[model samples]
Target: MSIDGNLLTLSQWLSPAFPVGAFTYSHGLEAAIEAGWVHDVVSLQNWLETVLDQGSGRSDAIWIRSAMSDDANLSDLDTLARAYLPAAERLREAERQGAAFVKTVNAVWYTSFPDLLLPLAVGAAAQRQRMDGDAVVALYLNAFIGNLVSAAQRLMPLGQTPAQQVVSAMTPLCLRLTVATRGASPDDLWSNAFLSDIAAMKHETLQPRLFQS
Candidate 1:
């Protein structure tokens, strides 16, 4: 496929309309909103910046890049990805979405992606398709952050324009992380987004929750 064709495929895989059910999971942003930790645009941006810089956002990107390697150990990576999660809700969030992504991709593209975490599943698929690693990880982060921004809109009084602004503001940081983590190994897969971890844990008990966590 041409370069344009690869970009088109990546865009579709990471698009909001993908069957991965990404919109259903907010990575605990719902709990943060309820707790007033992210009640406005500034706070939301701050919260997201931390995640992208030092949390699952960063770690998940590493996982994706690692999985995109030709010699990637998909089974082991999936196991580690499951264990690296901080909360059961988070594990389920990654697991269920990943399963859906794998199923849809397999059905449509005829690739074999075992049940893996969301990042690993996406990585393995991208590897098989010969997509660019940096672009794959970058767009994965974009979709990840985009979904959270979308969730914030539904959970709060945020408007479409502002929601877009958040994603826009996050683009450079996402790209930076992707660049920084290039050629990174699983040893570099670490997340210190503690508050987000707590939020995901707390989300399990949040009453009248709007997200699946």
Candidate 2:
């Protein structure tokens, strides 16, 4: 595909209407909000950036790179992704969204590649569509974070301008994460955000929750 085609494909995947159930998962942001860790716009932005930097950015990026390189070992990467989910609800969210994404891509972009986890499927799609690896990774990361920010705004009372600013502020960090993951390995996938994990775990039992975590 040409660069224009690649850009269009990236836009589709990164769009909020992609139908991968992204809007349904806040990656625990909703839980954070209820817990008061993300009561304001700035706190929400910091929470999201921390997740993109210390949590998903570090672990999922490594998984994407590993799956891209070792197609035969995709299962191992998937298993690792699964294991990294410290909460039951979070695990189910990842697996559910991942299966949906893989099915969609297989039906549309049908390659001989094996079924992939969420990050891996995204990476594979980027590769097949000839999108720039770093660009695709950054786009996905930002979109993922953007979804959380959007969810927070709706769940809370964050203003439109503040929400957009939060998303804008994340751009540089997304670029840095994409560049940093260039040499990352599967073994590098790790997160120490136990409080977030605990909140997600607690969310599973929270009465009347808005997000799947």
Candidate 3:
């Protein structure tokens, strides 16, 4: 596809309108907020950057890279992605969104790759549809970050403009990571956001929760 066409495709796939149930999960941001680790815009931005660089987001980027490549061992990758989730809510968030994304893309995009993990499914679909690999990674990361930020907005005193500003500020980092992970393999999938992982585990018991995780 032309560059414009590819950009349009990514916009559609990553749009909030995509029926992926992404709004239902916070990726542990709620718990972080509850714990006061992410109470304001600066803290939220830092938290999201950590996720994008060293947390599950980075791992998912690697998975997406594998899925978009010809040598992807999808079943094994799926298992790894599943086992890599640090907590139950995180696991549920991935699986539910993965299933929804797989169903929607298969029906709409007209291919039937197994409805596996979210990152893998999206990577497979991007490859099947011949979307630009870097664009796929960048767009996917942005969507993931955007969803979490939206959840934060609902769960805290964050305003719309600042939430979007955080996203905008993270764009360069997103593109840089997309480039960095371009040659990544499934074996490289790992995360180091210990605080986020802990938050996800704690979110299971967090009271008065507005998000699933």
Candidate 4:
């Protein structure tokens, strides 16, 4: 594929219009909001930045690089991703979305690699489509962060203006994360967001939840 083609594919994957159901999972943002850790726009923004920096931005990006480089043991990576998810609901959410992404990509394109976790599938698809690793990483991070922001907007009373601001604020973080993940290894894929994980676990039993995790 040409560079333009790769970029276009990345755009499609990053778009909210994609049918992978990424918008359904808040990655614990909903639970956080419900717990009052994120009540307003500023707090929400801070919470999201922390998540990006400490959790998904670092861990997922590391996994993405590993998947793209073919340095990841698929079974081990899958197991770790599953086990690392502290909540059953969160685990199911990732697997379900990952499966959906795999199926959708396979239906549209031919690839030897399937059964990838969400980040792995995205990185592999980006590589197969000939996207540069940096661009691929950036797109994945952007999409992930954007989806969370959208979820926040729904879960909270955040207006469009604040949501857009949140998205804008995340751009540099995504770039930095992409750079940091460029040569990251599977061993680097770890997170310390215990509270987020606990909240997700608790969310499984929370009454009247707005998100799947």
Candidate 5:
């Protein structure tokens, strides 16, 4: 694909309209809102900033780039991704979305690859197409964080404008991680956003929940 074509493909894959069912998972922002940890735009931004910087968001970026590498062992990578999930709901969220992504992309893009973890599936697909690695990882995080912000709108009083503003502020962090993770490997993956991880586990038992995780 040409540069323009690659850009278009990335946009479609990461777009809100993509059939990955991303909107249904909040990464536990729903539960966080109930606990008063993420009750407003600023708090929400802080929560997500930590996620992108020190949580699964950063970890997923590394996995994506790892899957894109020439010598990637996808089965091992997928297994590792599953092993690191902090909660059962988090595991379900990643598995279902990753499966849907692989099924759709295989039928639409005309290829065959086993269903893998979400980040790994995306990375392998991007590698197959020779897509830009930076764009792939950046936009994947963009969509991931953006979906959570959208979920926050329903879980809290955050309006569309404020929600988008949060996404805008988060854009730089996403881009910076893409650049930083260009040479990253899964061995370097880490998740220290304890609050986010705890929130994801908490969501498993949250009453009157509006999100899956």
Candidate 6:
């Protein structure tokens, strides 16, 4: 495929219209809202930046790059990815979205992705399709952050303009994280967004919730 072709494929796969059911998960933003940790655009951006920099976002990027490599351990990587998810709902979020992504890719593109975590599945597919590894990481991170931003929008009275502004402002951080972690292996994967993890775990028990996790 040409560069344009790869870019188009990445755009389509990462778009919200893709059947990953990503909107159903908050990545723990709901619990944060309940705790008053994120109520407006500034706070939301701050929380999301932390997640992007030190949470599953960074860890997933590392896994994606590793999986795209020639000799990735899909099985071991799968186990580690599952263990890396701190909460039960977090694990479910990754597994369910990953399964959906694999199913869609295999059905539509005739691709064969191992039944793995979301990041790993994406990495495997991108590798098979000959997509640029850095581009894959960047687009995946954007999608991840966009989903959480959408979640925040629904959870609060945040307006569309501010929400979009936040997303636009995050572009540099996303690109920087992608470049910084481009060469990372699974051994380098670690998460420091403990508050986000706890929010996700607590989300499992929140009543009248709009999201699954």
Q: Against the true structure, what is each candidate's TM-score?
A: 0.97, 0.92, 0.95, 0.93, 0.96, 0.97
Candidate 3 structure lDDT: 0.88
Predict model 4's lDDT versus the native.
0.80
Off by over 4 Å in 4: 1-3, 70-72
lDDT by residue (70-129, candidate 2, tens digit) is: 343676777777777787887777677777787777787765556556787787667666
Model 3 TM-score relative to the real fold: 0.95
Clashing pairs in 4: none
lDDT (Cα, tens digit) per residue for candidate 5, span 1-213:
445788898798888888999888999888888999988888999999999999988999999999999999999999988998888998999899999999999999998989987888999999999988988988899888889888888888888899999999999999899988988987787888999889988989999877888
Error of 2 at 3 (Å): 4.0
Model 1 clashing residue pairs (backbone):
none
**Candidate 3 residues 52-77, lDDT tens each?**
99998788888889888887778888
Report the backbone clash tally of model 5.
1
Clash count per candidate: 0, 0, 0, 0, 1, 0
In candidate 5, stretches whose alpha carbon ends up further than 4 angstroms from where it belongs are 1-3
lDDT at 54 for candidate 4? 86
> Residues 44-154, candidate 4, lDDT per residue (tens digit)?
878878878888667888777777774546767777777666678877777888888888888878666667678877877776676788888888888888899899889
Per-residue lDDT of 51 in model 4: 79
Better of 4 and 6 by TM-score: 6
* Candidate 1: tens digits of C-alpha lDDT, residues 1-213: 445688899999999999988888889999999999999999999999999999999999999988988888899888888888899999999999999989999999998778888899888888888998998989989988999999999999899999999999999999999899999988987778899999999999999987889
Q: Sort by lDDT, best first: what order? A: 1, 6, 5, 3, 4, 2
What is the C-alpha lDDT profile of model 6 across 1-213, one tens digit per residue? Answer: 445789999999999999999999998999999999998888999999999998988998998998899888788889988887899999999999999999999999987766788999999999899899989999899999989999998899888899899999889999998899977997787788999999999999999899998
Model 4 scores a TM of 0.93
